[model samples]
Target chain A: MSDPAAVPPLLDARNIACQRGGRMIFAGVTLTIGAGQSLLVRGPNGAGKSSLLRVLGGLIPCLHGTIDRHAPIALADEHLALDPDNRLEQALAFWARMDGVDRERLDFALHHFRLRELADIPVRMLSTGQRKRAILARTMASGARLWLLDEPGNGLDAASLRGLGDAMAAHLAAGGGIIAASHFDLSHQFGTVVELDRR
Target chain B: MTRWFLPLVRRDLRLAWQGGGLWMPVVFLLLVASLYPFAVGPDARLLAATGGGMLWIAALLAALLPVERLIAPDRDSGIFDQLLMRGISDEMIALVKLIAHWLGFGPPLMLALLPAAALLKLDGAAIMRLELGLLIGTPALAALGVLTASLVAGLRGAGALAGLLILPLAVPILIFGAGSLHPGSGAALKFLSAISLLLVAITPIAAGAALRAGRE
Candidate 1:
């Protein structure tokens, strides 16, 4: 268990609303995630699952409400969030540098994610699962307190899924938090589940 | 820090270099210039007089072609959103991208212009002037191109929109780039320099603001 008195809530979203293409996608969505807590958002396609993630990640504006972050946040949208033309190592290095992660941690992350051999390969050549592993490598390497992941499990195999679970557990154990939106059955691992109704 | 800037630049440059074969704009620029003599009836003087303008236009078009791809790949792959989440300011990302574009397209296009200049029968002084003007002016064009690129990065039909948005803003550079090869070369050169410097100073702010707006 985390010391709630010592660690603040990683994210606080109040009354958040999102509209896309002149239509209300979701409204009045509110949630809070604290250290050692993991929240999963489940909904049908186009239920604004990705929109909510974007809002929480600060990639898009929420039509209403405030999202406050207690620490740096890392988001992995449906997009791999990497430069496809760049080599895996180079791409992750750039992310690590941007997130202020030290070189040692980055190396450890690459090894942990089983990407050490393919580090020099351009991302375009990597398979979907490899690419997702690279993206996951970046998120874990980022060392951020709040993680906003959209469809994080899309390309993972069983082993990689276990790795993802392990990463989440480690992050939460270290006073980090996760807010992931997925269609998969992640309820057994996550601490809380928020279901969004179709708009 | 300066250290961060160098690595970013180096990595981007390497990627751009490896992907050099994918540059269709350079091929298009050469092909268009090669066709000009045939289209204009082999009039050396006329070609010489018009060559700088033609090359500048071609360079602008070619430079603009890749701007969308520059940011789109990052945006599509989710690296862009991650960058923002990591707390690197939008301005830095924009500036780094602009630098990468300049290094990737600007110098090679300038080199390719020599062959185009020869085919157009450009005199020595005119070639010197064209090269110098493009050297300074292209960076400014690239800077503005990046600004427009960031704005329309994820928008539909962004290629045409990029042309529309940047061409109007690039008028000053085009005017001076072409004018610098004429009789008023000295004055035009100064104007080009001033514009380049001004753009260098202001482009980051515009790109930074646009990036922030897009993120929001």
Candidate 2:
């Protein structure tokens, strides 16, 4: 792994607090991850893991503190964030085109995720694992420098999990970073781990 | 850009065509118009007299039915989030969605009115008037529907709420749409045209504001 001090931090979260439904999920949480580094955030169910991911992705309003990023970020939540009625290729192409990524990169990303065969299928027909793979493909195709993945390993088989690990490693090698929140044992793949207690 | 609009519109049109649910509005329009003759008996004059109003009411209701589903699929699949994050201005997003909704729901409802008009024994002039009025009025209904769709996009029972919110706003369109069918009613046509223009002008602003607010 590259030296943390040598690279600027891609994400800086200082004293971040998030509350939902009058319950405090987490408070006074400070964390930072730098370029070419990965931070795995582990927490139990209903512990605001997804909430934190949303806040980081700029989807949900943060209740307190600051989150600074040095590069553009891509977020992949469990919901897949894709139009179900749309063909897989069209949906990914739309997002990729909108994000200014080249078509070649998009095709490569889809093929890498083993989704080239299913590209023409409507998203509603895809199995959970396939849908997750498609979401990952879109995220990879985004070409963002920082990735905030809620559950990168969810619904993936052993081979796909390894493929995901390889993708993350490749992204890091290219001066990109990942902030993955997963319950699985990803310590071997990720450079660092940050575990949170249930509130 | 054609790149954005064409693909989006084409995709939506295909979905609307294949979904089967999109035809419900057309069915409702015909059903509602068919009821007019039955309720008032087989008097040709009575049907003629009430045909315009019946058609307009049916058209309005038809336009209202399928609007809730316009944004529901996107919201459910999380595509709305991706759209918001695409860096397109909220106004443009609202406009694109409005266009899609209009093409999917509005155009078909207008087409469905033709058969209904024939069944109501509307003469050529009345049929022409209804068509013209629908052409102008449907766009406005679509704009309003888009605003309502966005407002209720995240709510339960959004279909009911969409109807409730849109029907009241549609009163002017209804009046004008019906009035246009009267022979020698230039003033009504002019009024309808003016209202249509006003709605077209104001709809973008309302839709844009609502989308921006919702995103924020």
Cα deviation of B145 in candidate 1 (Å)?
2.2
- Of candidate 2 chain B, the 10-residue stretch with the lowest lDDT total is B81-90
Query: Which digits, one per residue and each the tens of the lDDT, describe model 1 over residues B124-209?
Result: 88888888998989898878878888888778998889989988989999898888888656888899999998887777788878
Docking class of 2: acceptable
True contacts kept of 1: 0.83
> In DockQ, how does model 1 score against the reference complex?
0.55
lDDT of 2 at A145: 86
Each candidate's DockQ: 0.55, 0.37
lDDT for each residue of candidate 2 in A19-84, tens digit (9 for 90 to 100): 776788888878888778888888887777888877776666678999886778888887676667
Clashing pairs in 2: none
Model 1 deviation from native, Cα RMSD in Å? 3.3
Task: List TM-score per model, in order.
Answer: 0.85, 0.86
Off by over 4 Å in 2: A1-11, A68-70, A83-87, A120-122, A187-192, B1-3, B89-91, B183-216
lDDT of 1: 0.81
Which numbered prediction scores highest in DockQ against the true structure?
1
lDDT winner: 1
